[model samples]
Target chain A: MSNKVLPLLMMPEGKEGKVSRINADRGLLRRLIEMGFTENVSVKIIRSVKGSLIVGVNGCRYILSKDIAMKIMVTFW
Target chain B: MTNNSIRVALAGNPNVGKTTIFNALTGAKQHVGNWPGVTVEKKTGSKKYNGYEIQFVDLPGTYSLTAYSIDEVIARDYIVEEKPDVVVHIVDATNLERNLYLTTQLMELGARIVIALNMSDLAENRGDKIDTKKMEKFLEIPVVKTVATKGIGIDQLLDTVIKEAKKGPHHEHMIGYGDDIEEKINQMENILEGDITLSKKYPSRWLSVKLLEGDDEALKKIEGSPVLDQVKNILSTINKEEYEAVMADKRYEAIDVIVPQVASRHDEKMTASDMIDRVFTHKYFGIPIFFALMWAAFELTFTFSVPFMDILDSAFAWLAGALADNVKPDWFGSLLGDGIVGGVGFVLVFIPPIFILFLLLAILEDSGYLARAAFIMDRLMTKIGLHGRSFVPMLMGFGCNVPAIMATRTIEDKNDRLTTILVNPFMSCGARLPVYVLFAGAFFGRQAGTVIFSIYVLGIVAAILTAKLLRSTLLKGDPAPFIMELPPYRVPTAKAATIHMWQRGSMYLKKAGTVILLGAIMIWTLATFPWGVEYGSEDSYAGKLGKVLEPLVAPLGFDWRIAVALLFGFVAKEIVIGALGVLYGLGEDAEEANISDSVEADPKIFALNSLGLMVFTLLYMPCIATVGIIKKETGSWKWMLFAIAYGIILAWTAAFLIFQVGSGLGYD
Candidate 1:
């Protein structure tokens, strides 16, 4: 495990990481948590192209635009 | 059997085939109306099985019971206040972990739960094995595997629901919220116990847990309670968001403990869905593929439905002629032949194209492609300063703008919702589609399909440009965050698709039977009055009104006749073509071909005027119902009037420009 944290958009394709923090407005953060993006939740980037990432979280795939992905900070383990 | 009458609710995350199960259970016994105040649909259906009468309420599909969205608030209130006998929780089998979050919340509410593991076949096809028996044991709930599309295991699910309902109320189905939160929850529950009014209104334990999590809806419910100040003081001691996050995490922890015991997967495999996404959502190819598919749909909607439309037109025309010839009184004959038959028949002929378009859209929506469309188009939507969630409502506008305006309630941002609602009418609903097809067929001839497709494209372009303009000028702000689930693509079932298509298509028929029927008779009465003047002639009332409006539209190359049709069009877009039918003196017995010939013979309407007319039709003030809804949804007569005024001004200017520019290029 590394202490380094980066925005979810920076995570390379096919890499798995855990959400460390959500740097967004209260409304968006609440929504992110509701969608299974809680802190320490493991997320695997299934595909990343053109700034949007298709990530696998909690056994479900979610297509996140760069705007949302950028607000999510994660740590790779 | 005690002849028990049970009330059940079907609840789940969106896109989990929950609606399919509801449809299967209720069949044709469903009645859909709006929720009391909100525009969200309330669906209730009943079924009698083996001496038991079961009434099922279909709750809105929600991600969680949080107060973040209207759907969530509505669903939460329904379960808390209505207290259904049994809640059949539908979960996507392949996505158990995330779906279980809702399941955990339901458990906290002490809901008597039966889990319908929907899409089991899809999960198995993805090489994920789900042990329902193990799942049932782990969660202390009945689990029934169901393939909703194929209608498998539905009876067993219902039987389990009936059994659960018969067992009175659930007493103990709580999920542990770890030590720290459990301590706080207990404290809150103790405080809540003193407030008998609150306890009687809500399940005390659930209220306590939600209050600790700082749930707004729950807090609002207990606002006047004696324990409110105490609970607020306690909640202030801890960070509200952190508590919410922690509670959510604890729920996930419960699911994490159950997952390994009940399910296994052979690694992560690239599914056929992923393969399709690779191409369809490709960075460069995605937009082109989307437009190409839209073009194909437009072509099919126009080309394939032509023969059916012709048959209907001929049948109605023959009936009108028979009535005109056989009836005794000429005015009575004219009322049957010209007023009723002409008005209704003229609009009814457009049904095939409307039905085909809705059917194609339903297929696209059910097969999961529409979500992908939204996902891929998010960038462009954000560029226009609108949320991607606005896309679905705009798509619905293609069916009708009234519902589309109401659908904007899903948009969380106020500015985004207002802007989306204002621009929704420009999406060229099916009611407007017939005007395009009629004009394009009359003038464009061999290129009618292309002309019609281009009109749709023009509509999209206008909607986008208007949105950008509104964003820059009136509705200023960034769009809400775009987060959407790209559901797995499944083959849309014919039964489900047909049912959806029929439901939407029938709305059009219902409108025709009621509103359009009245409009036609009114127009007929006006056109045929002052008995000496020929019907729809310049001396008649409708004709005189058209003459008055003719000067306003003349610059756009339209005459009094088209101007009068435009006036009638404000009532309903579909009536534009019908109005034109009456104004052209084609009568009810004229086929589509005859109407086209009539328009073709009129020198006042040529290629340029037709183009201008189509543009005006596309951009003009939305039909009356849309205006009413805009007022209702925006809660302002000011914005509604603004929408109407701006649309009319924009339509006139754009049509004038198109006509003037095209005439200079000598298009006619």
Candidate 2:
């Protein structure tokens, strides 16, 4: 079963895999959507330092707070 | 062709990469400086394209030409007074509807307009298509699609510009208001038309509309004119303070008509931008994300730059030793090796980390994320009595306090601007990076990165707290209402980001070479005074000065040497490291020399002294450049003195408390 929400920070360590198919929660999720991160869009984790991660989603890289990353659930494909 | 040298004005909303297009149009041929009578920057450049010597004037970006803000006033004044042959209104394609709002206002300015649709790639990727032919036909001007940074469709843009400029300014095809407003505008225009000076310069209808809107500058223009009393009587009869509201309503009415016809909606699903904005600005997650992102940036600055810094440190150390060995003992040797190279090298070693930090900030800014960061912080900023707009300038302060202080022009209120300028020094500018890196490296090991990160956080906290205290007392006023435009996210170009990083990084180097060099020389003199007993010793001039000041700083756990360094740091904080290097008798090149063995052999000797020194450095007075900028910007010496006095007192008190408490807890 695919997770309901994929924490953006915990996406696999490498850049080759598909992002988990999960809905972002409200507020932050809405903000993310407004900034062009939508459902089914593939994202790649570019760099992870300590707990925080910088992810490439829809051709732009976004720095994700580590705490926000924990709530996002993803399915590895 | 000489007579055909068409003057073109490039006008646009902020952050649409209009500057990028300006750079592309006139490579290596641009002059940038402050606009006269105000601090708003004026950038002019020239390019010869298609037999036309296109002199492009980049107007300050504005949302509308309503004359409510300085930028609007400047933009409107240039369009009316300078009378450019063609005005290129660059609009971000992805956010077409909101961008077109400005284009609608531009239509009323009586200048020939051409719309440059920027960021076409983002629009195409999202499957939201713009019918440029339809847009052009509706707006009655030429439309050019451009991705400015990549040089896409630039030749076509220039071709259209030349064609449009050749036709000269448009006499017809102007956007109009409602019949009632148009009638009032005509009446006002008829009365004002006799003034040849105003008639020749400004559009009669535009002036009339501005009069209706209560434009202060426009009012001042006709204030003492013979028609002033008649205009006032007419205004009072209309039962309005000014024509501003009427004009604004008409413009919005025109926008209401134009936007819907030109802009179209696609699939009803959430746009990628909207989805991402949710999480980034979520109430619970927003502040945490901001802090986390900031922490990550600091971590990268402190950690990633270490290897490069080590390389630079070793290279400088090698250069110093080689010069010492090859050159015979003389004044030239000491001056070149110690004064110029050593002093400058101490400052230069910080370039890598600061460069990286700037690179990240440039990316964040270009990606359109910084606006969201500001949006997230607006509520908190209001509570602290600072407008949300103050955050961007303060964030820029982290790179260099000069431009950041200058950026306070964006804040409309005088008090808010002054308050922001006053607290800007507490943001721990790039000049203080060397101080943190030096001591953080010496005492904290790998954890030094975290320690440095906390110092930045502490600086921001202090700034916010200080802003609160000042607002409630000296500059008491309501924070300006938060209103900001969050530009659409785009793939930030590597070239643009690199140029930004270089521009800022080179500025840091320039400051080091000039101000920091003079500061270092002054510090060296102070350290070497009473010429033979050794520099930085208790008998030396700097030491004696510090000794005289020590009693005041005693509570702050600072000795004479630390006090002296703090004093010199007021000239430039980067000089504190050079001052300490000289005082410790650890040659300028000793940053690379591992003094670990000497310190480890005598644990009681304590590198914690250096830690105390770092704390003091972190919290000291604004640097010389910052002080000068504050004086110029605030136009008052009293605030400048207040900044220095309060900063020094706060730094001493914080350092003293940290040292006393830490020592009392036996950590030292």
| Candidate 1: regions farther than 4 A off | A1-4, B1-3, B195-197, B224-239, B585-601
Candidate 2: tens digits of C-alpha lDDT, residues B267-335: 333456656866886757888998888888878888888888777766655665455445766434544
Report chain A TM-scores, every model.
0.92, 0.69
Residue runs of model 2 more than 4 Å from their true location after superposition: A1-77, B1-6, B27-31, B46-53, B222-242, B266-269, B321-329, B382-389, B412-419, B471-478, B528-540, B554-559, B581-607, B632-638
Worst 10 residues of 1 chain B by lDDT: B587-596
> Poorest 10 consecutive residues of model 2 chain B by lDDT?
B594-603
- lDDT, candidate 1, residue B95? 83
DockQ of 1: 0.57
Q: How would you encode candidate 1's per-residue C-alpha lDDT over B1-668 as one tens digit per residue?
A: 23599999889998899889998999978888988988898889999887789999999999888877888888878888888889999999988877988998888777789999999998897788899888888888999999999999999988998888888887565588888888888888889889888787788888888887778888899878888899888988998878887777778788878988899944545778778888888888888998888888888888888888778766666666666567868777776776677678878888999999999988988888877777677778878988666777887888888888887877777898899998898898988888877778777877887888788788878888999999999889988667778888889999889888887888889988988888778788778887868877889998899889989998899988788888988998878877765565455444434444555678888888888899899999989999999999999999999989989999999999988898898887
Model 2, clash count? 38
